[model samples]
Target: MRVALKYICEDVDRHGNVRCYVRAPGKRKVRIRALPGTPEFMEEYQAAIATAAEAPLRQADEAKRGSFRHLCIRYYSSAIYKALDGSTRNWLRRALDEIAQEHGAKQVATMQARHVRRLRDAKAEMPAAANQRLKALRALFSWAIEAEETKVNPTIGVKKLRYQSNGHHTWTNEEIQQFCERHTLGTKARLAFDLLRYTTGRREDAPRLGRQHMRDGRVRFRQAKNEHRNPIDIDIPLHPALGESIAAAKVGANLTFLLTEFGKPFTANGFGNKFKDWCRQAGLPHCSAHGVRKATSTALAEAGATPHEIGAITGHTSLKEIERYTKAARRGELASQGMSKLIGKTTA
Candidate 1:
């Protein structure tokens, strides 16, 4: 009997036997391995259909030659783009894709600095996002120039919007205590807190931590940002507080210390969202994982650690970045020292 089912196909072999398979768009064909009309056949067919549903949609046809889309497509396949870190590639692709979607039909050689400024000014409400778009366009055109795809860089001379604001909020001692009281030791929340607080790792680096990183009483791991281009290997002594939390949590033989409820290692974004939920539950809605890192830097500076010393722990290559993190603490420390010198109490 001939059966009619969606995504199901049958081919007769030379031996007069028919093989059934589930052939879905954008997905590999899976052999049903069961006779048609059986439960097994339907089960496998359903699974293949689901897989196809989850597969990314096929992209539109390639743009005409010398179009903006064509240029972006070439840039995407270039060695320069491929060499970028995974996160960087993803973000850059997203930014460029948005531009290509809007202006893909335009000639790449005709783009001017005014067009770049227009794109940047469109997101004027969000200065950071505007700057990011400009930054992505600059990189794309720069590569195109190097590859001889185009002679002009439209992004040239486009200034990023200036906005004054402190970055992530630095967690206060009281906020830390509140979170600690809410999420006691032996809990994942507390473990996450200690990891960021004591290790000075960014949110992106936290999910990568595991027992493998522990060696010679120090935690050693490469920072995730710009890892492929300029890897920064951090090797710092483990703090007793973090060690206590890790021990209390009783992390099993997982490759990573932090795991989702499904027992899989967390993606960076996933970990950050989960950490945010943990903070909310602790009644510290404003506290974040990065705030802990800032707090660590401030604490270290207040404890008389030099900028270089803070840089060593935080994996910061620039002294200016370390200074920004410890700015308030440094001011307080200098004030105290200045007063001491004036009062002749420097010896004490």
Candidate 2:
């Protein structure tokens, strides 16, 4: 029996049973314990290849292939997509799916400016989703152009949707206290809340943060979002209150500070769902994991922490972002002080 030179690797088990595996880079191996040239062998091989076809970027030469879907496939397989954290990749995947479903059959070169705007406008109601989709499209075409899969990037000039509010709402001190009262000292909700409020860690990084990240009186971890482009190393000094909550939760040697009912590490998305439930229980439906992060930033800025100082704890590489919060805090202080002076003058 003659086996093809590619995708199939022959190996033997310790029990002396021989097997053929369908091997693809960055994918799990599929074993078919059948001899080559048999119908069973062909069947398994075709099935495995079909499954492998769904994953992008495995074939180094595929960048030059087919349509928008092909470009996205290559994009997904590229180092850029691989570099994203789980949550980011999940969003990118949805964006890619949206792009492929709409214009996948079209040639990459045919994606003009108007076409890009059309896609962006379609998602105008959800401004954030629209912007994120545009981001994914930009990444895809940018990769396509650089990879020589396309001549131009249509998403390059397309503007993001204009929304009224800033990204996430900051939690108030009163709301924080209310949440604390409901969740209590020893509960997982309190621990999780403090982990964000004190450490200034994003939701994606917060649940994953554990005792392992703690060393020399600081908790350290890399920021997961867009890590390839602007990787951030967050080293926050351990806060005494957060430390107390950690002990109260009996976090133990469980590696992660927060665990599921089954004693496994909480995934970013899973923790978010649970956290939402915790918020609802506390009658704070408007609150979010990111809101707490913003709250901490606002608190620090209001207390006169510099932008760089705030960025250091929050792992925000962009000073502009840090400054936006600082500027807002400064305005609030100015308004209060100015009003106080006016009232004092009136009384005198």
* The candidate that achieves the highest TM-score relative to the unseen native structure: 1
TM-score for all models, in order of appearance: 0.80, 0.78
Worst 10 residues of 2 by lDDT: 55-64
Candidate 2 — which residues are off by over 4 angstroms? 1-65, 336-348
User: lDDT tens digits, residues 1-348, model 2?
Assistant: 342546778788899987889888777988876456432354357556755666463343344466777787777778877666545666777888877775666777777888889988888989988888888888788777788877888886789988887767689999999999999999999999999888888776777777878888888888766565678888778999988989898888755788778665666677888998999999999889999999999999999999999988888778988998899899977998889989847753
Give the Å shift of residue 22 in candidate 2: 12
Question: What's the alpha carbon RMSD for model 2?
Answer: 9.2
What lDDT does model 1 reach?
Answer: 0.83
Clashing pairs in 2: none
| Residue 41 lDDT, candidate 2, scale 0-100 | 50
Once model 2 is optimally superposed onto the true structure by TM-score, how far is the C-alpha of residue 69 displaced, in angstroms? 1.3
Shift of residue 48 alpha carbon in model 1, Å = 19
